[model samples]
Target: MIKFFRKIRQNLLSEGKTAKYFKYAMGEIILVVIGILIALQINNWNEEKKYQKQLHIKVHSILGDIREDALQIKALLKDLEKQHSAADHIIPIMESEQKAIVDSLKFILDFNSFTTTPILSQQNNTWDYLSANGILSELEDQELVNLLMNYYNYFDELTINFNNSANPVRLELRELKYELFTNTEHRKFFPTKKPSVPSKAVYESIFNDIRILPLCRYIGSTAAYFEGRFKDVDQKAEKIIYYLETNYQPI
Candidate 1:
């Protein structure tokens, strides 16, 4: 193609048609520019297609994360509901100083399932992409961003509060070690390998021992609060699923 154009220019110049040669040269430059522009436009189109494909994959991965998160939240919700019920039963009995309440304490103690590591792991990085990269602006539903924002705020607060206040049950447990272990009657609860060795002050304190009803109630209330939060999360998750289905393509 270059040789054809160069030959035409040489023929025009050899015939002393200087003005005509200049005109032809300008026309050739225009054609070259048009070709370059067309090539650039095609390149851009191909790049956009690739980007859209990658974006679809990213959205699908995030959708999977959200689905798994919903399942985890469901499990936590079920556990919380059960804990709330058990606490309700035990709270009343605790007031009456029933020995059965002692066994019920184990229910609360055994309630731990997913550690903090897994809870944080469930939070998808898509939220960060939306916030940091303005990706959420591209989402068809702005409400999806709002839903995720609300979830982030709620979970942040809940995790902070829980981390700060979670150990009261463990703290109240020290009293059991000090006071109850000394009681010869309670010795059956302790293993013989680690004999009960309460000090005389511990023994003397039992007569004046105060119940930890407040602590137990507080723990139960905290569990119930977390349960309510998870219920809200579950609802938001449904909305997220709807958003994904409506706006995002699986491919």
Candidate 2:
């Protein structure tokens, strides 16, 4: 094509047709400009396609991370509720006449420790990477970003606080309960399938103990807070999942 154009220009110039040569040169210039414009347009399209592909990969990774977190948190949430149930049993028995029952004390011995807590698994790497590198915005889902922030920042911190607070308090409760009961009674309560009756005075001592009640209150409130936060996280995860399943796709 270049040679063809060159020959035509040479013939026109050699014939001294300067006007036609100028017109042909101008036509050639226009064609070159059009070609450049087309090249630039194609480059821009390729860049956009690459951007979309990257966003799709990041979004898919994030969805997978959240789904795992959701599964783990579901079990953790149930565990928190179970702890609450344990607290529920202990508190009522202590507050009521049933405190003297051997079964009640056995239940207390089984469930009174705050050592058991929900173990939450977080899928933070995906979120942290996308966020720190500033790729999270590539997906253009501001709502999803905010929800993730809430989970990682606020909700994760809530879980940490709940666990940290329980640790020292659990030790204190264990010490106090041992102090309130005889070694024989405490040991007997544990291995006994059917808890045998301890003296009413033993029950009264535990019930009237100032230390025990505070520990109970702490356990109850903490369990309640944990349960609520678990539910809140569940809802947040579900919403993101819904958005992903409903609206999610390769960009």
Candidate 3:
């Protein structure tokens, strides 16, 4: 194609049609400019297609992370329910003057239950990557982006609260456990170790401790509070997952 254009230019130059040659040369330059523009446009289109594909993969990965978070939240909620149940059962018996003679094993088990703290493992690696790289703004769905920001921010606040508020309470509970229960009593709940149950007197000592009632109440209340928060976040995660799945296509 270049050789053909050169031959045409040479003919125009040799024919002594100077004005015509200038016009032809100008036309050839314009055509070359247009061709370059077209090539650039094509390259831009290819780059855009590649970007869309990468965005699709990232969004899908985010969906997977949210799904995993939802599952973890569900498990945490279940554990919280058990903790709440244990507190419910233990509190009334401790409060009553005529304490019901609950089974020693059952009392020990409930003691262990309310004291166990459920830690939520949030799946935020993809989100962290996007945020760190400034790719979150590249997401075209503004609503989804806002939702993600709010969701992660909420988690961050929750983590901070847990560290500042809940950790001390948990640590106190651990101290109380050591103070109230003997080593044999502590080992009773271990599944792998079939240690002999502590005497009834040991169980009664824990049950009679007035301090435990308030701690149980605190655990119960916090369990309920965190359960509500976990459910809320899980619902938001599910909403985000549904939106991504429904609106996005594989590129």
Candidate 4:
């Protein structure tokens, strides 16, 4: 192409048409400018396409993380619900019925000691890049960023509250363990002494009377709170999915 343009310019100059040569020379300069402009446009288009591809991959990854966290939260909710049910059964029995039933309540109190598995921590690396690197600024609107921020904040709050509520149950369980093992009951049930009904159930009733029923109800409340938060997390995940489907594409 360069050779062709050079040949045309040489022929026009050889013809001694100075005015015509000036016009042709100007035309050639215009064509070269146009060509440069087209090349620059193509380069910008390719850069934009590459960025969109990366954005799609990041959005898909975030969607997958949301789905996995939703399932995990649901499973944990069910386990806590089961623990709550068992405690409910033993609490009423200890409250109004036989004092010997307190041994069963002690077993129920042990349920309170079962720690809740913590929820997944916040993962915002993709979000940070898109926002901090000005990728999000390049987005046509703010809707996508707003939606993600809302869901992220929701799960972060859920994890904090869930752990806070579970703390009392742990304290109750620790105290119960101390009462049971620090007395004659430990020796009677373990390596040396023979076990008897009084050592196993009757005397243990004192500790049970002091602690069991109240602690079980407190544990139930904590478990129920966790179940409610699990539902909230699920709702937030659904919201995120809805936004992704409406405004973003998968890679």
Candidate 5:
């Protein structure tokens, strides 16, 4: 191409068409500049397409992870609700009441179920990775970002509360239960196999333990708090899922 243009220039110079040569030279320069701009434009377009495809993959992966997160949060909510109910059932039975063997076994079972553990929070592994990589900014929706931030922030707070506020109370109650009722006694009612009928003595021990009432209240309140947290997360997750479903196409 350069040789062809040089040949044209030489021919114009030989003919002494100086004005025509200048015009032809200017036109060639313009054509080269325009060709360069078109090439640049095509390059930019291809880069945009590549970035868009990458963004789509990340978004779809996040959606899948968030979907599992929704399921986990829902399951946690149900479990917390159940624990709260068990605490409710155990709260009313005090040392003053003379309960039957059936009632005693039920109370012991409920008590064990309620105070034995703390509620674990939902996981956000995909969001964590994306945030670390500065990829969350690629998300177009500000509301979705805000909701995700709020959800994880609340989850961190909930985890701290569970570990600090609830687990200590649970441990305290567990210690008291073991102090009053031996592991053999716990196994009698809460056997890995079919539970044996608990004696009235076991019921009396649980009822008479002064720590039991306060422990029940603690368990119920903590479970209620987690339930509320999960409910808020549920709303956030539902909104996010709705937005992604409407606006995002998974790869």
Candidate 6:
């Protein structure tokens, strides 16, 4: 093509039709500029297609991560519900005159509930990768980006609250166990060890302690709060997943 254009230009110059040559030269320059622009536009289109393909892959990965996060949140919610149930049972039993008559094994199990702390384990590896590489900005759907940000931010807040507030209450309850319960009673907390049934006196001591009831209430409240937050996060993840699956198609 270059050789063809060069031959045309040489012929125009040799003919010495000066005005016609200038016009022809200008037309050739215009055609070359048009061709360069067309090539550049094609290149831009290819680059855009490549970027969208990569973005779709990343979005698919994010959807998987969110689905896994939802599962983790579901499991954590179940554990929290158990803890809450334990608290409810222990509180009523302690308040009742039949506290001593309550099954020793059941009472010990409920008492041991405070020792278990449910922590949120978020599946955010892909999110972190996108953020670190500044690829989040490349996402065209700002709404989806916002949803993702909110979902991950909720996890951050949950972690902060657990560490700063809920965890301390749980730790205090655990320490109280050491001060209030005998070694035999403590061993009941572990299911593998078949400890002797705790004495009525042990139940009496636990029930009579001023610290136990309030601490149990605190633990119960924390569990309930975490359960609610986990549910919200699960719902948000579902929404984001649905949006990505429905709207995004790779080039």
| Index of the highest-lDDT prediction | 6
As a whole number from 0 to 100, the lDDT of residue 249 in candidate 2 is 75
**What is the lDDT for 179 in model 5?**
83
Q: How does model 3 fare in lDDT?
A: 0.78
Off by over 4 Å in 4: 97-125, 128-134, 139-144, 171-175, 178-214, 242-250
Q: Choose 2 or 5, whichever is better by lDDT.
A: 5
User: For model 4, what is the error of residue 33's alpha carbon versus the real structure, in angstroms, after optimal superposition?
Assistant: 1.4
lDDT of each: 0.62, 0.75, 0.78, 0.66, 0.76, 0.80
Ranking by lDDT: 6, 3, 5, 2, 4, 1
Candidate achieving higher lDDT, 3 or 4: 3
Which portions of model 2 show Cα errors greater than 4 Å? Answer: 95-98, 102-106, 109-113, 171-211
Which of 1 and 4 is the better model by lDDT?
4
Tens digits of per-residue lDDT for model 5, 5-95: 9999999999999999999999999999999999999999999889888877776676777788788778777768887888667665552
Better of 1 and 6 by TM-score: 6
- TM-scores for all predictions: 0.70, 0.77, 0.89, 0.73, 0.85, 0.84
lDDT of 1 by residue, 1-251 (tens): 78998899999999999999999989988999999999999999999888778767777776777888788878767766765775676566545643343442243332221111113345667666757887766655567667777766766676566556654453554455445544563453243444434344433343234654555566667677877877887887778778888888677
lDDT per residue as tens, model 2, 1-251: 89999999999999999999999999999999999999999999999998888777777888888889889888877766776777777777767764545575546554544545455567878788878898766767788778778777866787688668855676677677678778787665544676665655566776788777777768777877878977888888888888887877755
Best by TM-score: 3
lDDT of 3 at 53: 85
| Model 2 alpha-carbon miss at residue 91, Å | 1.6
Q: In model 1, which regions exceed 4 Å deviation?
A: 97-121, 129-143, 166-211
Clashing pairs in 6: none
- Residue 120, model 5, lDDT: 57
Displacement of residue 8 (Cα, Å) in model 6 is 2.6
Model 3 clashing residue pairs (backbone): none
Candidate order by TM-score, decreasing, is 3, 5, 6, 2, 4, 1
Clash counts for the predictions, in order: 0, 0, 0, 0, 0, 0
